[model samples]
Each structure stands twice: as C-alpha cells, then as structure tokens.
Target chain A: MKKDKIINRRDFIQTGIRTGIGAGLGIIGFGLISRSVEGKTIWQLDPAKCVQCGNCATECVLQASAVKCIHVTDMCGYCDLCSGFFRPGALELTTGAENKLCPTGAIVRTYVEEPYFEYRIIEELCNGCGKCVQNCGAFGNGSLQLQVRQDLCVNCNQCAIARSCPAEAYSRVEPETAYLLKGFEELKITD
Target chain B: MQQSIKHIKERYIHLTTIIIGCCIFLFWLFYNPVHNFTEAVPGLDNRPPRSSSLGSEVIIGEHFTFFGNAPDPSLTGRWPNFRGADFDNIAKDNVELIDSWPATGPEIMWEKDLGEGHAGVAIYEGRVYVLDYDERKERDILRCFSLVDGTELWRRGYSVPVKRNHGMSRTIPAVDGEFVLTMGPRCHVMCCDATSGEFLWGMDLVKDQKAEEPLWYTGQCPIIDNGVAVLAIGGNALLMGIDCTTGEIVWQTPNPDSLRMSHSSVVPMTIAGKKMYVYNALGGLCGVSAEESDKGKILWTIKDFTPNVIVPSPVYVGDNRIFVTAGYGAGSALVQINKSGGSFSARTLQIYKPSEGMASEQQTPLFKDGHVFNIQTKDAGTTRNQFVCCNPDDFRNILWTSSTTERFGLGPYIIADDKFYIMNDEGELTIARFSTSTFEVLDKAQVIEGDDSWAPMAIADGRLIFRDSKKMVCVDMRANE
Candidate 1:
C-alpha cells in the first residue's frame, strides 16, 4: 500500500510541472495574437511620395495627432545647422524655444562634435505637424520624416488626416511594413 | 520836444531790430540741414524683407555646415565646372545609358523640394553642388550632395532677403578641386572650400565693384580658371579675375565703352592659337585677351550685333568664326574674327531673323559634328519651339526640325551617350537621337509636374538631374537596370 502511494505522488508531480509549462506558453501565444490584432493594418506614410504638407499638424482625431518626426541615424548628415532643429528665422544656433524649428520644440539636438550633431524627438512633445520634415528635405538629406505612431493612433475607420492629404501620402500598410522608414534599404517607387 | 523825439526814435529802432532777429532765428530753425545717417555695413546688412535693389547687403561667412558621408570615387564622371569641363553642355560619361526609358519612365533615384529658381548644378568627383535661394530663410545657400544617392553633404550661406523677380538664384556654382564660386542674385560673390563647408571669402560686386544690377538679378554664372574666379563684372571693369584663395583682384579689363552687364556668362575660346575670353555684354559683344601677357586687354569687339537682352554666351566655331544669338526679336548673328600680324579684327558675317533660320530664346545651341541644334524661339512662326538642326556652313539651309507633335519650350537639352535629352517648360522630357537627315524622338516622359522646368540639365555617372521652378530630381539612366 505504501509503495503504490509513493508512485501516485511522483505521477502527480510530473503532471503539475507539465501543466504549468503549457499554461505559461499558452498565455504568451495568446498575448501575441491579441496584440497583432489590436495593432493590425494601421495608417502609415509613404516616405517617398510624402510632400511634407502641414496637414499632419491638424486634422487628427486626437487633439495632438499621433504623427511625429522619425530620424534615420544612418542617413543623417549631422549638420550643426540642422534644418529640422532650427527655425527658419533663427537669429543664432542655440537651444532657445524661439530658435527651434519644431513649433512645440519636440526635437532635441545634442552636440556630437565640432561639425556633427545628433537629433532626437521627444515623442511626448511632438504634434506630428510635418514642418520639420519640409525644412529637412529642403536643406538636409531628408533624414527626418513624418510617421503615424500606431500606439497613439486610434485606428479610425475614416482617417481625418488622409481625407485632407493633397499628395495622398497616407495609406493603410501591412503590419510588417507598418512604418515607411527613411533608412529602409529599399524604397517602394510609386506613380 | 527834440529830446523826447530822439528818445522815441531810438526806442522804435531797437524794437525793429529785435523783430528782424526773431524772423531770422525762425528761418534758421526750419532750413538747417543736420543729417541723420543709417550707414550700411558693406557685406553685412541684417537682411530686411523686400530687398530687391543692389547693395542690399547680406551677412557673409554667417553659416557653414557639413552633412552626409562621402561616396566612393570610382568611374565617377565629373561635370566639375559649368557646362562640363570643356565649357560645353555635354556629358563625358562612357557608361552605357538607356537610349529609351522603361514603361514606368526613368527611375527617380531621389527627389528634393527646391525653392523657386532655375539654378543649375555641377558635379565633381562624386558630389553635386548647387547655389539656391531659400525664400523662407531669406538667404542664398550653396548646398552640396552625394551624386549617387542625393544625400546632402554640406551647405554654406548668408542671409540676404530677395523678392521673387521672375525667380531667384538662376546661376550655377562653379566648382573646382579646391574651391567653389557662387554669384548670388544680388551680386554677392562667395567662395568656399569644395570638400568642407569652410567659408574662404566673400565680396559684394555692387558695393566694391559698382556693378549695375541686370534687369533681372545676376544671371552671369561665375567660372573658375587656374584657381581664379573669372567674372564679367561690367562695372568699372568690363571683366575681372579674383584669386580664389586670397580674394584679391588679379586682373581687370577696362570698360571703356561702359558696356552694361548682360545675363550671359563668359566663354573661353581658342582662335588662331590665341585663347580669349568672349563675353556678350549689354551694349556689345567683345573678346578679351586671356593670355598671361595681356590678360585683361580687349582683343576685339563688335557693337552692331548688340542686343539689350543677351542671355546666350558666344560660341566659337572652327578657326575664325564666333556665333552670337539672342531672344526677344533680337535674332542671331555670326561674327568673323581675322588675325593679321598680331592685330585682331572682327566683323558681322551673317545676320538673320528668327523665321528665316535658327534662333533660340534661352539656352545656347549645341554644336556637334558640323551641325548646330537649337529649339527655335516662339517668334519663328510655324517653327516655334521646334528642335531644329542646321548645318553650320549655312544657317539658312532647311536641315530638319522635330515635327509639330513634340514641341519643347525654353527647357534644357544635353547630349549623353549618343542621345538627345530634351526637356520642355511643361516638364516633359523627350529622348531623341542626334540626326542630321531627319528629326526623330525615341521616347517621352514627364519628369516634374511643375511648370517652368527651364533649368539646364546636368548628368554625371549615368545620373541625369534637372529641375523645375519648385523641385529637382535625380534619375538613374544606367543600362541593364
């Protein structure tokens, strides 16, 4: 009777371990599947065709649009006179709000060297206006571009910004190609 | 009574003198000319808005910045100077280029939004350079970029507010191994290091040289020669050469005729073993000595072929012929230069109206294989805007013209890989073979949607670049792609 009881105890221990592992795996898989569905087929911008109009600054379901300037570090010129950082009427190169290119002062510039600099966007400050992108494309390498942050976007059935885009730059892209990255090796050429 | 009368007369005389003094004091207060002055600092005016006049100064050496990484320099065809190294708008690349584009059209390698202008571009080693006017910034900027990828390398500029007069910044930057020279729309001359955005020197042609502003801004593109910036100033000096490195006047040609400035750039030509600088000034056309012995002396000049609006530079053909032409009903003329015993003489050989032969409104004609090809001016009756080819021996001979189906306005044309690339003002670019017997177009494509795509075309390393009033594009013309 004692031997039989010991055998049952071992069997119970093995089943408990197996069940625990299976439940852990099941939870991870379910979380991934749900996340994919939540963020599926979000609105994005085609970097190649975007005209950088100021419409992204407005025409959003949110008071502050989910659009923001994304910098491609590999393609950056690192110019001290960064068009995306300094305002057009800036009297001098400084960190003052009056001299900033971003209306909300979202871009933060850090000096890397005598002629080089690094720019980062404080996402919290960005309103997705696209003014900086226009300036950068005009005078820089276009390293700074506009993007729709899916996390902040509501995935509206009818996008308010797309309805007003003159270039028709906004579209619903697959999740794998969610963002039109500037440094992305291949750019999709469109008509 | 006599004493009282004398005392009253003295009092009356004192009162009259006091009244007269008061009147004189009033006159002095009203007419005194105490001057108040706002003396402008020569090259550093704080760029006020709506500044279209000459001597409206700009801050020189205000900004210099470097961007983008350099490209690998191999088989990189160079358009290092204006109109290529030979001063002719011809590509020196041997890379096999597509004679015709694919159905999707010539693939745009990259595109950049530009401020309003017709500024052309120059490519050297593996970089492209252009002088552009930033309307929002109110400054003239010299931007450098990678030729293969359209990535910006650097920009050097200063603030000088300019209004839209037709357009702004129409001249291209002259780039060499060491320096790049740019002539701003308001006559500000700037030179910077070619590789880095180092400001070497800047000069105001209006303040220092007293050059009269052309009806438009300075359309005369600067050219670099032997480390000197060659400029047709037409100020106190008809022409002047500045040491690019030191910013010193090396030589100056006297403007005895007081010929005003024209929009045409100077062309260097060798006639009878003598190299001369030929310029089409406002009052006349002249050939000046480019020799070290008498570098700035006028070799020969002609006033009969003068046109008030001269845009095309004079072209040298064969041993003794210099062809000159202009638009606005000014027509075209062929001038013959005769050298006898070290003395030079010039005379107009043939003069013809637009309808009679060949005339171009904007771009200089291309002279290739004993034939001259030009898009005829709008005044040429039925042949208006037609790409017409004529034998140089007889400009009047009916050679061939593109059919009425494909007409190009004042856009640019360049010969590359044995094909004629012609762009129209409406932004349609056509590719045609160079033929003397017949006019034929192989393909057509719209490059830019904007109007006034009149900037001259530039090509390097099988990359074709052209611009309209609003934007510029770089296209891949490489073969087997």
Candidate 2:
C-alpha cells in the first residue's frame, strides 16, 4: 500500500506539471490571437515629413528594402520635362538611361499626351533612394514619394529604417490600412 | 486482423491531410494582398485625364497657391517700385529712425527663406511683395507677405523652367494700390491684383514680343507710371508701355537697330522741359519719348556708349547729364542730351576707365545735393570697391571714399532718414551718416549670414528690408519711442 501511494503521488506530480504547461501555452496563443484581432501596429513613414535623405534605402535590415517609391497620379503635373525623371539640365526629354535621374531606372515614363508624360514607379526595382522624390519636390509637383510597401515588409519589432530616419518620419501604423500617402490630407484620410 | 485495419485507416488519414495541404497552397498562390489594398482607380471618372491640347511649354501664372490670410496691420508705408516712387533709392518719409544701432544690433522684425536668388522686395502699405523663383516647382513665384510679421499671405507661380544662371529671379515687384507687376527671369511679365493677389494678365516677352532673355536672366525691374507699365523690351521693340488695367500694349518703340535686351533698366528722365525714357541698351544708349504726344519714339541714340554687359541704369543728373557705367572694365560714360528745334540729340561728353575716374560696378550711384555717391568697382585701383563721392561736373573728381577698411562688393546701398545703408557681399550692413564731405559709419552689424547679398535694399515706415542670395530679413529701424 505504501509503495502504491508513492507511485501515485509521482504520477500525480508529472500529470499536474504537464497540465500547467499546456494551460500556459493555451493562454499565450489566445493572447496572440486577441492582439492580432485588435490590429497590431506596423512600421510606416509619413511622406510629408520625409526629407528624402536616402536612409530608407541603406538602413533597412532586408537586402531589398520594404520602402519603395510610390506615384500619386492624382497629384502629378504630367510634365513632359519631368524633373524627377530626367536629370537637371537634360538636353532632351527622352527615355534614355543616361539622362534619367533614377539610378536604378525604376521610373517608367509613358507619353500620355503631347507635353504630358506619365511617371510610374516599379516597386521591385525601387531601392527607396529618394533621389526622384527630392527632385520632384524641388522642381515638380510632389507626386513621387517614398512609402513602405507592407507586402514586402517583414514587420520587424524594431524597424531599422525607422530608427535611423533623420526627419522622424517613421511611425507604427495599423496593418490593415498600411499606407501613409500624400495629396490626401485635404480628404482627411490620414490621422 | 485488428492491426491491419488500424494501419489502413492511418494511411487514409495521411492521404486526406496531404490533399488539404495542397488546396491551401493553391489558395495562397492566387491571393495578392497588395493588389487588393492599393486599388488605384485610374479611370477618367476618378481623376481628370490630361489632354495633349492643353497649352504650350511655358505657361505664365498657371498656378496660384494661397497660404493664409494675415490681419491687415494698416501701416502707412510705401516703397512702390525698383528705386521707390521717386525713382531714387531714398526713403524721405516722416517716420523717424534711430541714428545708431544697439550693441545687440538692429531688432530683426522678421526673416524668410527665399529660393537661390538675389531678388529684392517692394513694400506697399503693409504688405511686402517679392518675385521669387521656386526651383522645386520650377516656377516663378510672386509672393506677398505681411510686413508686420513674416506671414506669407499669398503666392502666384507660373511654371517656366529656368536653369540657374548665377541664380534666377533677379527682379523686384512693382506694387501699387491696384496692381502688382513682376517680370520673371525669362522675361515673362505678370500683372496681378495688388490687394486680392488675383492674376489680371500675363505677357511672355519672349514668345509674344520675341524679346531675347538677358544672358544672366532678366535683371530689369519693371516700373509703373500713371497706370502704365513701362517695360524696356529689347527684341521687336526697344521699349514698350502697357496699360496696366486693360493689359494693352499702349505704345512700343520699334527696335529698328535690332538692339538685344540687356541687364539694364529704363529710367525716366525730364531734361530741358522734355520727358523721356533713358535706357542703356546692349547695343547703345537711347532715349524714348515719354510724352503723351510722341510716346514710344526714339529721340536720341548714342551708339558709342554701348557695352557688352550694361548693368547700371542711366542715372540722370541735372544739367541734361545722364551718367552710364558698366562692369567688365567698361568704365563710365557721361552723356548729355541737347534739345534743338524740338528734336533731341545725345552726345557722349567723356568716357574714362575705372582707374581714371569714378565708376560703378553694380548699383547706379545715388546723386544727392549736387554730389554723386557710388561704390567704385574692384578695378578702380586705390578706390576699388570703396564707397566714394564724386562731382558730376567732372568724371574724375572723387571727393571722399569709405577708405580701404570699408569696401562693398557688388552689393547695394540706399539712403533713408539722412543715413546710408550699405551691404557687402557677405551681408554685413553698415549705417553711415549721409555726408558728401566725410564718410562716417555710425554702426555696423551682420544682418544675414550668407553669400551674395547684392539685392537692392528697400526702406519705408522705419523698416529696412535686406536680403542675401537665399534669405530676406526686415529690421525695425524706427526709434524706440
């Protein structure tokens, strides 16, 4: 009877420890689900505050930065001699890479009409260099801007780009509505 | 028999799990979150589609951006045009100013960052108007600000791609009660409602008049005379007068000699009871009729006084003398216009090198009380870059100079409240007691910490407006009451 009692106690202790660990895991999983449902914040940068310092390209932890250039077609001037696309003092407004301001040639210029050209950004080729953004703001309508593409973003706990942003343009945003776009302030879409 | 049945059931379950995994993989492959979220509604309904038949390459006064309205300070002051209302850089209003600045320096009323240019300002009532080039927007912006505080009231911009030729936008706005006139770097003239900042009319001198833009952009500031916008257009017409209200070319002096536009501006002078407009054209010196009877008629021309780069406008001294000086070692020339038989003829009296006599590099000398004040050119030998006083009687008589220690480099100076406000290239301001016999700097202070502070200064209502290449500042020169 004494030996049987000792064996039962040992078995009870093992079972209790196993139950406790399982309950703890269950509580953690529930918390994670609730947090996600409540809309966990992801990193974002305000385009208005961004100074186009080229840090979004180099400071990101990923080999290909989540930050990319976004074209706000609504705000574009549709200029033939787009300062953002062509180099300053460009002899001709052509699609030549030598005359292009973009180092990666990510901006595709489409001749929409006479004296009006459309500027589109290729997300994959964009390294978030901000050279185009700087020139566009300097000489054209500020349509070319940098934004963090949430699809490519790994959503790190501490974004490396956010930490190094000189203009303090970076902040955490909701995952569902991820973009911080320009030319939308009048619509009051941004908080 | 029981072991065989259990093993078969387990195999069936494994096959079901594999099928479910494959279905999930297929669903993930087709779904694209980026595509779903960023719904770029690029249809014509969402945005206005840009059409090819919109306009030309350069549009004048195409965009008007309103910042914020400022409270009217109701200040009574006026520095209306390039050289003020009198066509002389002298503020002779009743407002009293301090004789000397405090050790802490003049109280800076306000300051604003402009584009990379040396454009000056025009103060009318309580508003300050400046013609600035926005390099980012690639537009010429005529900005109106509150003189009390540095609040930008409104801005009118037009896109005209101007390369930075020694910086752009080198003209001052001519603001009156009714209209504000601005000439862009490319010789595009815009006239706006002075109070409302409404675009009244625009004329592209290059396109409409075929006026060739000056080498370093249009340095000629526009002037308004009795509601007539006087412009020294030098392509098809040597000089043109536009009706400010109707936007009509009232009179235009035909450019028969094909004189190209120069950096010099037209100065209206009345000599021998005859009113005329004296201009230092790139090719020569000419006087157009400013009278109502024979307006736009070229009366006198001295082809001998032509310089490759003429900057200073013709300074008309008494005794029918007009002093013309130019940089690039062009020296100075004294031209006299004589009226004979209701006809005008110009004669070049004397021409001397900078080292031989009084010559100005940038600004037209201030003639006051029978003495002419000028900052001599760097090529003036002992008087190089020095502020000197000379007699208009002789081109070589330099009575007084600011000395070797005080030199103003291509900067500008103005006379206000019996004091001379001189600025150096580095923006050091010197306030000297206005005296032709002696040079005395009452106080000196650094107003702007930048290079190329060569824009002409404007003062009214005890407020002095000065600028560097990149910034403009206003200081309260009113005496502490």
Candidate 3:
C-alpha cells in the first residue's frame, strides 16, 4: 500500500510542475499579443513634406517600388492643359509620346466635358519617379502624390526607401492611417 | 615555289574580276537617276491632331463641383449687395459690437484659403458668396460657404483663361434671398440659386453685348434691384436691366457717345427729386432713369468731371451736387445738376487738384452728416494717404485728417457700430471712432498675414467677412457681454 501511495505522490508532483510551466507560458503569450495589438505600426509618407527626390523609385527593395502615385480626384482641377500630364513647354498637348510627362506613360488623360480633362494613373507602369507630381504642385492643384501600396509592400523591418528619403517625410504610422493624403481635410466625401 | 606564286596571282586576278562585275551589276540594279520631290499632302502621315485647343470656347457655368454640405445654420443676417442693402458702406443692423478691440483683434471665427484674388464677399441669411478665379484650372468659380464655420458648400465654375492682372478676380457678388449674381474677371455674368448652387443663367457680356473688357479686368459689381439685374454695359449699351426671373433684357439705354466701361460700379442715387442710376463711365458721368415708365433713359450727362481712368463712383450730396474723384493726379470735382421743366443741365460747381482738395485714389468718399470722409491719394501733398474729413458745403474747409503715422493703403473701409473699420495693404485693421471733428483710433491689430487686403468687407449677424489676396477670414465682432 505504501509503495502504491509513494508512486501516486510522485505522479502528482510531476503533474504540478507541468501545470505551473503551462500557466506561466500562457500568461507570457497573452502579454505579448496585447502589446503587439497596441503598438502595431506601418510605414507612411507625408506627401506635404515630400520633395519628389526620385529616391523612392531606386531605393525600394522591390523590383518595382511599392510606392505608387495616388490621385486625389476631389482636389484635381480637371484642367485641359494639365501640368501633370504634359511636359513643360510641350509643343502640343496631346496623347503623343513626345508630349507625355511620365517616362513610362502611366498617366491617362480623359475628357470630362467641353474644357475639363480628368487624369488617372495606371499602377502597373508607375515607377514612382514623381516628375509629374513635382510639376503639378508647382503649376496646378497638387492633387497627385506618392503613397506606399500596402498590398505590394513587403512590410520590411526597415523600409529601404524611408532610409534614403532626403525630405524625411517618412514615419511609422498605424495601419488605419497608412496613407498621409492632402486635401482630405478640406473635402468631404459625398454621393 | 615559282609555280605556286604564279597560281596565287592568277587566283587573285580572277577574284578581282568577279568583284568588279558584281559592283557594276549592283549599281545598275539600285541606282535611280531621276530626282523626285513632291509637296507632302496634309494628313498623309498617321499622326493624330493635337487636342490642346484649350482656353477658347468656354461656355459660362458649364460645370459644377459640389462638396458635402453641412447642416444649414439658422442665422438670419444679410449684407445683400456690394455695399449694404441701403447702398452705403455701413452696417445698419443692430448687432452690438465691442467699443474697442482686445489688442489681439476680434475673435477670429474661421479662416479659409481662397484662390488668389481680391474678390469681395456677399452675405445672405447664413451663406457667404465670393467670385474666385482658380488659377490652376483657368476657371471662374463662384463659391458658397457656410457663414458660421467657413465650410465650402459648393462651387459653380466655368473654364475661362484669365491671365493674372494684379490678381484675377476684382468684383463682389450680389446675393438676394433666392439668387446670387457674380461678374467674373472676364466680364462673364453668372447667376445661381443662392441655397442650392444650381445654375440659373449666365451671360458673357464681352461676347453678347460687345462690352469692352476694362484694363485689369472687370471691377464692376452687379446689383439686383426690384427683381431686375442692372449692369452698366459699356460698348453697345450704356445701361441694361435684365429681368431676374426670365433672363431677358427688359430695358437697355443706347450708347450714343461710345462711352467705354470703367473700373467703377453703378451707384443708385436720388437727386433733384429724381431716382436714377449714376454711373461714372470712362468718357463721362451720366445718370440713367430708374423709373419703370422711363427706365434706362438717359437723364443727364456731364463730361467735365470724366477722368481718363475712373475708379470711384460719383457720390451724390444734397442740393443737386455730385462729388467725383480719381487717382493718378486726376483730382476731385463737384458737379451741380439743375432740372427745370423736364430738362436737365449740369455744370461743374468746383474742381480742384488732388493737392488742393479731398481726393481718393481707389475707394469712393463716404458722405455722411454733411461731411465727406476719404483716404486721400498719394499725391495729396501733405495729406497723402491720410484719412481726411471735409465739409462738402465748403471744399476748402478740412475738418480733420488722420495723423501721418495712421495712413492707409488702397484697402477698403466700412462704418459699423458707429466706428470705422479700415484695413491696410498688409492686413492691419484699425478701428477709429466715427467723428467729424476729430480722429480717435480705438484699437488696431494685424488681422491677416498677406499683402493687398484691398477687397471690401461684409458684415452681418456680428460676423465680419474679409479677405486678403489669398485668404478669407471670418471674425465675430460681437461684444463679449
């Protein structure tokens, strides 16, 4: 009987040790999850501070930079002679390849009305050169800007483009505020 | 070795003979002796035509962009027209204002960024209207904003290329309860629903009426009187009254003398027991009959007081006299009109140079209580840029002039709460007690941060709206109590 009791005691002691270790691990795991939820962040660029330095195109780790041009249509003036679409002092404003401002011909110009023209960007061809963005801000309403496309971004531990940006417009932002857009405060979305 | 050398020479000769024959054959096959040059036919090349025929063929009020609308506020104050409802630069409302400012100026309610221009504001009910020129789009936009918070409600615009001339927009919008009328920098008149921003009608005066575009664009503000919009058109007609509801020309005064449009607006004046629209045209000063039966008929005209460039409208004083002034050393003149037996005649009562009398460069002199008040032009000798008050009965009698340190630029001034709110070129606002005998500055502060704050101000419901070249601000001028 004593022998059986001794065996039972040994088993109880072993189980207790295992339970204590599992409880401690559970507590540690819960704390780590909560901390991550509170401090999760993503890299974002403030367009207002961006100087269009052309580093975003080359410094990105991706083959094609995850950075892409974003069009805030609400702020766009819909101008016929869009400074963003045509090269400075362009002989003729047309869809001809010579007059295009984009090196890769990513911007598409469409007629909206008698004198208004709408501009849109194709993401696949964009190289984040920011040439159009620079000219647009200088001469027209600054509706074109650069942003990191979350789906294309690899979310590296240290963003390559952010390190090389001269303007230091890059900062860590939460996922909800992944984009720093202009004219968003002044304009409210309507039907 | 000798035999081999002979063989090599023979082979070389054979190769050379074959090469010469091939060259001759190639020249015969490819050479063309006839030179052919023909004129190239147009469109033979497959290149597309350029689409850059812009800055032409702009239909006024063709497009509208709407932002989200805020809940309409229930404030009921109105500064309906260019001046006030009474056609005076005075706030007649009973909104009590503080006697002095708080050194930091009045409490600014809101600030908004406007297109670069000096276009003034018009307030009606709880909405504010201004005609702004969008430089990037080359459009004239009539913007409406909430009076309480300065939120842009909506905008109606049309693409018209207006090159920058001392900042583009140069006029104020006139708003009634139902409709708002705006004259663009290029003389495009647009009318829209005041509340809904729906376009009602538009007219290009330069195209339709052949109205000459004045230098530095149109500075004439439209006025709506008794359901009719009155505009002093200068090429084809002297004055035109359009029915506001139907967009039809109700009456037009013929321009017999080829008077050109000026940078001045039409002022409705009652003189010598006659209600008329007084206009200071580039060629002459004339009065048009405003009575319904004889509407748009020329009542009287005098060419003696006409300046090469007139900026200030004729101010009507009592006893059938009108005070006229201009900048650039044109000086000041007073004209007396005598009406007898349904006929009118005018003669200059007194005319003096800017240095000898009270003169204005930009704004019209305010005639109140038998005294005229104006900021003298830069050529007024000792009183240059000084705010001077003079007795209209005697042009030689100067009542008071502001100190030399208290000079003003070409900005605008208005009377509210028995005080004068005047702004300078750099947006420094000064409030002075409105006294004929003396000038007492109650307070002063820098309200805006830019240059050329020359646009006129509008006040209503204790809210004063003013603008610099690119920023518009709203301030609550009510007393704290």
Candidate 1 chain B: 10-residue stretch with minimal lDDT: B38-47
- Docking quality class, candidate 3: incorrect
Q: Which scores higher on lDDT, 2 or 3?
A: 2
TM-score each candidate.
0.64, 0.64, 0.64
In order, candidate lDDTs are: 0.82, 0.84, 0.83
| Candidate 2 C-alpha lDDT tens digits along B88-124 | 7889886878888877877998999999887999999
Show where candidate 2 strays beyond 4 Å.
A1-191, B1-56, B69-73
What TM-score does model 3 achieve against the real structure? 0.64
Question: What would the per-residue lDDT of candidate 3 be over residues B75-119, giving only the tens digit for each residue?
Answer: 888898787777778898888887777766568999998888888
Question: What stretches of model 3 exceed 4 Å from their correct place?
Answer: A1-191, B1-55, B68-73
Model 1 DockQ class: incorrect
Best-matching candidate per lDDT? 2
Q: Clashes in candidate 2: how many?
A: 2
Residue A96 C-alpha lDDT in model 3: 73
How do all the candidates rank in terms of lDDT, highest first? 2, 3, 1
